[model samples]
Each structure stands twice: as C-alpha cells, then as structure tokens.
Target: MAGLFISFEGIDGSGKSTQAKQLARALEQAGHEVVLTREPGGSQGAEEIRSLVLEGDPDRWSAETELLLFTAARRDHLERLIHPALAADKIVICDRFADSTRIYQGTRSGDLRNMVDQLHDLVIGREPDLTFLIDMDPDTGLSRAKGRGGTEERFEDFGADLQHKMRAGFLELAQQFSDRIRVIDGTRDIDTVAADVLRIAREAVGVAKSDA
Candidate 1:
C-alpha cells in the first residue's frame, strides 16, 4: 500500500514476463528497492500450487477448481512477499496477477466472470497500482509461447482459438479498468516496448529520468 504495485499482463508469449523483469532491474539500478515476483508462484507455497495448476493437462482441473487453487496461491504470495515489500516502501513488480485468472479461468470455458469477481473481491482484494497490458496478435503470441517447449504448456496447449478470445477479453478488461491499465503495443521490438514500459513506470512511481 505504501509502495508502488505494478503488474505486467498479456496473452501468453506477449513478452510481458520479459518486460516485468526489465522494469524491476531498471528500477533497482536506479536505487530503488524492488521485489520482482510472479503470481501463483511468488512464495514457496504458491510455487507448489503453480506446478499443480500450470503443468498438468489443460482439462486436468475444472475452471472452478483452478480458480480456488489460484486464489490460494495468490493469498499466500501476498501474505509472504507482496505485502511486506510494499509495507517497506519497495516497488513490487509482478509478472502476472489476478487479471490472468480473470481471463484464463473466468471466461475461457464459460461465463464465470461473475464468480471470478466475487472470489477476487472476497479473498484477494488488492490490485496493482499500475498495470502494463502487452497487446499482441493471438496467432503470433501462441506461436511464440509454444516454441518455448516446456512442461507448462497447459495454457499454451489451449490452442490459438483460446488465445484470440483471451486477447479480446484482456482488451475489454483494459477498457473496464482504464485508469490503471496501460495498453502497450507488444508487436514492436523488445527495446522499444521496454522503453515505453519504463517511461510509464517511472511516471507512475514519480521517478524522474535525471534521477535514473
């Protein structure tokens, strides 16, 4: 609450993870204390839950079940890592947050967005002060994601159709929460995108370019 809370969100392979890391590093080098973490896996307990939810078959868990698991992991992550860092006035840059679940489990299968909101409001009441939504073409993002070739293909395995739907869903959510979400064109080169991300982040955190 006292510090800046930032989250990077996007369809898979949209380069959000890379941008999150870069922001954290850049801020740290600028003499700020930074906590760079990710949802469903920031804390040790959450990391365990992450494997359960990310590595299995796409249909291994129903949307309802996956929602509960993700909520649990998020609670643990906040209690263990996010809260304390912010309390100490450190910048918290998370790769992904509840927004992902709102799209992934909320609307991927059915109209569960209401249920997702209720659960989020009940158990995970916090949101990032700033969010970077990396907008990318679904086909391009899916191809990039699958090329990584890891066990966490559960979501990527959902195929291009899901990616397209998710891309639309995220854009809609961005409009819904326009005050906090900054939509960035992720189709550009990495450096260009990162520069935009950093500029916006510095503005949000009140860091001047000269200070950096």
Candidate 2:
C-alpha cells in the first residue's frame, strides 16, 4: 500500500506487455525501484497456477473454477511479492490485476459479477493507484494475436465475438474507474503508444506521491 501500484490491461493483443515493460524501464531510469510483474503469474506459485489455467483446454475449468484459480494465484502474488515490495516502497507495475478477473468472469452474467466483487472486497481489496487500459479494436487485436502464434492461444481461439465482448468489458471498466483508469489509444505505433503511457504514468506517479 505504500508503493505506487500500476496495472496495464487490455484485450489479448493490445500490446499491454510491451507498454508495461517500457514504462517500467522508464520509471527505473528515473531512479525509482520498479518491479514489473503480471497476473495469474507474478510469484513462483502463481506462475505454476498460470500454466494450469492458461495452457489447458478453454473449457477445462468452468468460470467459477477459473475465478478461484485466479484469486488463489493473486493471493500468493500479493503476499509473496506485491505486498512486501509495496511495504518497502517499491513501484509495482502489474500487467493485469483483479480488473482482468472482473471482466473475464463478469461476462458470465447473473451472480458471477456480484461474486467477483464480494471476493475481491473480502480477499483482494487493494487496487492499482493507476490503471492503463489499452483501447484497441477487437479486429486489430485479434489480427495481432494471430501473428504471434504462441501456445497461449486459448483466449484468441474464442474468436472475434468474444474479443468484442472483452473489449466492451474493458472500456466499460475504464468508465467505471475513470478516475484511476487511463484509456490509452493502442492503435498507434509502438513507440507512440509507449510515449503516451509514460507521460500518463509519470503524471499519475507524481500525483500519487504528492497526495501521499
């Protein structure tokens, strides 16, 4: 809680990883101790759970099951990595956090959304000081994803329909958390996007420190 926690979120091919890395390097160059990590996998145990949830068949785990796995992974990540780093006053740049879980599972409808909220409030109450929501067209994201050809292709296999839904979900989240979520335009070239990310991140980090 003492550190500045930032999370980058977007659809599969929204370049969240690249931008996150760039931001971490930028912050580090600015003399800040930054820890760049990702969700479902940040710590040792979480990485193991990541493989289980990401590599297998998409339907291998039900929505509820996946939620449990993600939440479990998050708990370990926070206890083992995030919380300690933050307590030491390190800048933590997370690729994705609970927002990913909220949108991914929240799409299932009914009480699932409520469940996510309750679980997060009960177990993972913390939120990023700033959230970068890379906004991109689902078509563009899917195309980029296809070009990657990675084994972690389960999410892409869901087709454009799901990607559209996911995009909407993220955008909706940006509005909901607009005070903290900066919806960055992800359609531009890599450097341009990174520049925008760094600018906003610097502003947010500065403001967070000022508020503190």
Candidate 3:
C-alpha cells in the first residue's frame, strides 16, 4: 500500500476511540489526507453487521458465529474502504481492527485463537501498519463503558471478569505483535494521551515534528 495504515485498539471505554479521532484531526491539520474509519462499520454492509454484533444480547452470537460475522464485515470494509483509501495514498486511521476480534471472539470461550488466525489467513489477511493499544484498568474501563448507556452494551454486558481477561489478552497480543503495536497508558488525561498518540503517529507516517 502507498499509505500509512494505523489502528487504535483497547478494551471497551479505554478512550481509544477518542484518541483515534484526535490523531486523525492532528494529522489532517498537519496536511495529511486521512480516512478515519472503524471496523464492523466502515462500509454500508459492515455497518449493518455492526448493529447485529454490537447492539444485541451478549449471548446473541457464539464465538464461532461472531468470527464469521466479523470476518464478513471486515472483508466488506477492506474492499470498500480501507484498500481503496490506501491505494489512493491516504492515511487510514481505524478505531479497531482484527486484533479486537482476535481477543474478543478468540478468547470469548475456550482457545479459539488458532481458529481465528486460520480464518484470518483465509479471509482478512491485512493488519494495520501501526497500532496503538491503550492500556487501561479493567475495572475503570468497564465502568466507563457501561456508564455510556448505549445499545452497544453487548460486550460491556459481559461484565468485569471478562474485561480483566480482555485487558490481559490485549497486552499479551501487544507482546506477540510488538513490532507494530505501541502500548500507551490510558489512565492519563485525554490531551496528554492524545499528545503521545499524535507524536507516535507522526513518526510512523514520517512527518517530521517541525512539519506538524
């Protein structure tokens, strides 16, 4: 691809979404062409799937089923948005990507990580060139997620135990993909965190500090 691909990932309410937007805006102000999009909803078809997977009951879909749905949505997103944007030499800033599915669905029950990896190899094979994993306290993250009071509570409804597990899983995944994943503390204030995120993003996109 001709463009930089970046993704923001974290447990629910980890402020990754906010950071993704901030990074996008900062990069845009720096005169970079950026496409800020999210998984499971970047394309029209994927958006429909997002409502199905994110807004329903926690038990509405099995881990295996979610893997399929997420893969389908991701395929659409890649074909319709991500690939083209990158081909156009535009920076792609995604709020979440395959890593989210790998952690959420891969470990939702037993060890489906192998299956997730195999399916990803078979379907959605692309990964972000750079990823920002916002590390946060699971307890605080769950509380913040639930307090939002939205229909996307399906994952949040899984409760604190899962949140803790997810936080650990994400950190482990960061280790596994350490070359591309950057871990950032989410406990800091928004501007501080955004400053860190923007600094790293600027570096990855090869924008000199003076240019920004």
Candidate 4:
C-alpha cells in the first residue's frame, strides 16, 4: 500500500507501452525502486495464458471465456509480481490492467459492467495509484498498428467498430475517474507524450512518498 502502482492504458499503437518503459527508466534514474510489468502476461503461468488469450482461436472463445482468461492471468500476475513488488515498496508500472477488461470485454460483450465490477471486487482489491489513459483516434491507431507490419493478435484483429467502442469506453472511464486517471493525447510526438506521462507520474510519486 505504501508503494505506487501505475498502469498505462490505450488502444493499439497509442504508445502507452513505450511511455511506461520510459517512465520506469526515469524513476530508476531518480533513485527509486521500480518494477515494470504487464497484464495478461507478467508471471510464467500468466504468460502462457496470455498466449491463449491473444493467439488462440477466436471463434472458440466466447466473451465470458475471454474475460475469465484475462482475469485468471491477472490474478496470477498480482500474486506473483504485483503484490510482492508493492510490498517491497517498489514503483510498479504495468502496461495494462483491469480497466482493459472493462473497456475491451465489458464494452464489446455488452451488459458486462456487473461482471467487471464483481471481478474488481474479488480480484483487484487495490486500484492503481495512477492510470494514464493515452487517448487517440481508433482509425489513426489502427493505421499505425498495421503499418508496423507485425502479426495481428486477437484484439488487434477485432473489427474497426469494436475498436471504436473500446476507445470510447476508455475515454468514459477516464472521465469517471478523473481524480485517479489522466487522459493524455497519445497522437502527440513521442517525446512530448513521454514528458506528459512523466509529469503525471512524478506528481503521483511525490504524493505517495509523502503519504508513506
């Protein structure tokens, strides 16, 4: 509870992963202990689950099934990496977290708010101290993602409509939790975006250190 738990979230190609890494490096350079991790794959077992969730047969996996799989991996990640790092008072930077489920699964599946809420209550008992939501147009993100020429994962393979919904969901979530979440313009230059993320994280770290 004394450590800072930060999560970065956005649609594909929003550059949150890159920002998260940079922030972690900056914190380390400032003489702070840091733990960089990601959801759906942080621990050994969770990584395997991540493969199933991302590279598995899409037709075979229903919405509920996908939700469970994501949560399963998250639970393992929490037990193995996240919780221990927090206990050691290390700044934990995660690429994605439970909000992803609410945006991707809950929005895509429809009427899954209750499901997301229940999972949050049961599994993610502690919320991130700060959540940086890198906001960008779905079309732009998808174009950049495709231009990268990488193998498409399950989520990446989702149709444009679903991606749009997910983007909207993220924006809504940010609005609802404005005090704990900061919505950054992901379409900005990488350095600019990184600077913004760092500023937010620095403030959060200062508050957390003071509270400790």
Candidate 5:
C-alpha cells in the first residue's frame, strides 16, 4: 500500500486516543490526508456491535463470544473504513487494533492468545506499518479511565490487577514486534506525549513513502 497505517495501543486511559487525534491534526497540517478511527466502532455496523460488546453485564458474553463480536466489528471496520482509506493512499491512524484483542481477551480468557493470532491472520491479515503502545502505570490508567465515566465500562471494570496484566502483555507484544511497534511513556504531559508521537509517526510516514 502507498499509505501509512498506524495503530495506537495501550490499556485504557493511556492517552492513546489523544495522541492519535493530535497526530492526525499534525499530519493534516503537513499536507497529508489522514483517517483517524477506532476499533470496535469505526464503521456503522461495527459501532452498533460495539454497544453490544461493551455494555451490559461483564459476563453478558463469554470470552469466546466476546472475541467473536470483536472480530466481526473489526472485519466491518476494515472493509468499510480502514481498507478503503489505505487504498486511497490516506494515512490511517487507528486508536486501537488487533493488539487490544490479543491483550484484552488473552488476559481475561487465559490461553487464548494463539486463537487471537490465528483469527487475526485468517480475517484481517494486515498489520499496521507502525504501532504506538502508550506505556503507563496501571493505577494512573485506571484512575484516568474511571474519570472518563462512560457506559463502556465493561473493560474498565476489570480493575487494577487486570490492567497490570494488560500492561505486561502490551509490553511483551511491543518487544515481539519491536521493528514495527514503538513504546512511548504515556505518563508525561499531554503535549510532551504528543510531541513524541508526532516524531515517531513522521518517521513512519516518511518510511512508508520511501517504501512506496
């Protein structure tokens, strides 16, 4: 693809969304077309599925079932939004991507990381050119998440322990995909974090262009 594909990943409250938005603005000002989107709710169909997967009781869906719903949403999101945008040579800045599933479901359901990878390969098959993992203390992330106060409380309801596990999982994934993933300290000031994000993303954009 001629366009750059990027994903921001982290435990909830890692300020990934803020950084993704800021990067989009920065790229736009630099004369690039950017599509800033999120998983589980990027497209219309996926967004409807988002409410189904994120709301209600924590056990409203079992691990396997929840994974299925997320996969379906991701497929819709890619087909309707991400794939098209990338094909048109626009930078796609996604707030969260498959890494979230590999971490979230794997942490909750135990021994399912393999299944997550298999499903991703079979369905999505595409990986971002660059991924930014916002690293932060679990307590800080949990507190920030709680402050947001939204109906999508199911994941946030996992509490501190789960978040700690998620942090470990994300760090592990970043190591595994070190060539493509950048772990950025997210506990810093918002502008500081954005500056780092912009620095890394600009490099990814340049590399993608060179590759093209």
Candidate 6:
C-alpha cells in the first residue's frame, strides 16, 4: 500500500509501451526500484493468454469470452507479479490495466458496463495511484501501428468506428476520474511525450514519498 502503482494507457500505436519503458529506465537510473510490467501478459501464463487474446482469430472469441479471458490473465498477473512488486515497495509501471478492458471490451461490446465494473472489482481490487492516458486520434494510431511491420491483432484490426468509440471511452473515463488520470496529447514528439509523463510520474512519486 505504501508503494506506487502507475499505469500507462492509450490506443494501439500511441507509444505508451515505449514511454513506459523509458520511464522505468529513467526511474531506475535515478536509483528507484522499478517493476516494468504489462497487462494480459506480465507473467508467463498471462503472456500465453496475451498471445491468444491478441493473435488469435476473432471468430474464436465472443465479447464475453474476451472479457473473461482478460480478467483471468489479469488475476494471475496481479497475484503473481504486480502485487508482490508493489508490496516490496517497488514502483510498478504497467503498460495497461483494467481501463483498457472497460474501453475496448465494454464499449465495443455494448451494454456491458455492469459486467466490466464487476470484473474490475473482482480482478483489480486496488486502483492505481496514477494513470497516464496518452490520447491520440485512432487513425493516426492505426497508421503508426501498421508501420511497425507486424501482423495486426484482432483489436488492431478493428475499424475506425470501433477505434473512435474506444478512444471516446478512454476520454470519458479520464474526465470522470480527472484527479487520478492525466491525459497527455500523444501526437507530439516521442521525447516530449516521454518528458511530460516523466514529470507527472516524478511529481506523484514525490508526493507519495513525502506522505510515506
């Protein structure tokens, strides 16, 4: 409880994963103990789940099935990796979290708000101290994702309409939790975005350290 939990969120190709890594390195360089992790696949078991969730054929996954799979992986990730790292007083920087499910699955699936909420409660019992939402246009993000030269995943293969809805979901969540979530413009230069995230993270950690 005394440790810090920070999560990075954004649409695919928003550079959140890159930013998370940079931030973790920066924190480590500053002599802080940092645990860099990701959702749907932080642990070995969860990683296998990630491959299934991302690379698996969309025809094989219903909305409800996808949600359950995500929560299952999350449960394992939280119990085996994230919680323990935080308990040991390390700064845990996660690539994504429950918010992604609420946005991607809840919004896209329609009328699943209650289900998403219940799954969130059951899986992630504690909220992160700070969450950075890197906001960007879905088209731009999709283009960037394509440039990465890898096979597109099921989520990545979603059309612009779904991506727009997903982005809107994230924005709504950020607005609803303005105090805990910081929305950063992700269209900017990578270094600039990274600097903004680092500053916010440092401030949060400073406050946490003082309170401790």
Best by lDDT: 3
Q: Write the residue-wise lDDT of candidate 5 on 106-161 in tens digits.
A: 66876788888899899989899999999999999999998998799888886899
Each candidate's TM vs. the true structure?
Answer: 0.96, 0.96, 0.96, 0.96, 0.98, 0.96
Candidate 2 ranges beyond 4 A from true positions: 109-111
- lDDT, residue 15, model 1: 96
Tens digit per residue, CA lDDT, model 3, 1-212: 68889999999999999999999999899999999999879999999999999988889999999999999999999999999999888899999999999999999899999999999999988989999999999999999998999688899999999999999999999999999999999999999999999988878888422333
CA-RMSD of model 3: 2.5
lDDT of residue 199 for candidate 2: 91
* CA displacement after TM-score superposition, residue 14 of candidate 5 (Å): 0.8
- Locate the minimum summed-lDDT window of 10 residues in model 2: 105-114
> Model 1 — which ten-residue stretch has the worst lDDT?
203-212
- Candidates 1 and 5 compared by lDDT, better number: 1
Worst 10 residues of 6 by lDDT: 150-159
TM-score top scorer? 5
Estimate the overall C-alpha local distance difference test score of candidate 1. 0.92
Q: Each candidate: RMSD to true structure?
A: 2.6, 1.3, 2.5, 1.2, 0.9, 1.2
Give the whole-model CA lDDT for all candidates, comma-separated.
Answer: 0.92, 0.89, 0.93, 0.87, 0.91, 0.87
For 1-212, candidate 6 gives per-residue lDDT tens digits of 67899999989888889999999999999999999999879998899888888884656687888899999999899899988998888899999998898888887776787898897886667778999999999999888876787543677777667777888889999998898999999989989998999999999999999988
Candidate 2, position 43, lDDT: 97
Error of 2 at 56 (Å): 2.0
How close to the true structure is residue 98 of candidate 1, measured as C-alpha lDDT? 93
Residue 210, candidate 3: Cα error in Å is 16
Tell me the tens digit of each residue's lDDT in model 1 across 137-212. Answer: 9999999999999898899988999999999999999999999999999999999999999999989888422333
List model 2 lDDT by residue over 52-160, tens digit each.
Answer: 8877576777788888999999999999999999988889999999999998877743448888889999988899989999989999999999899867777687789
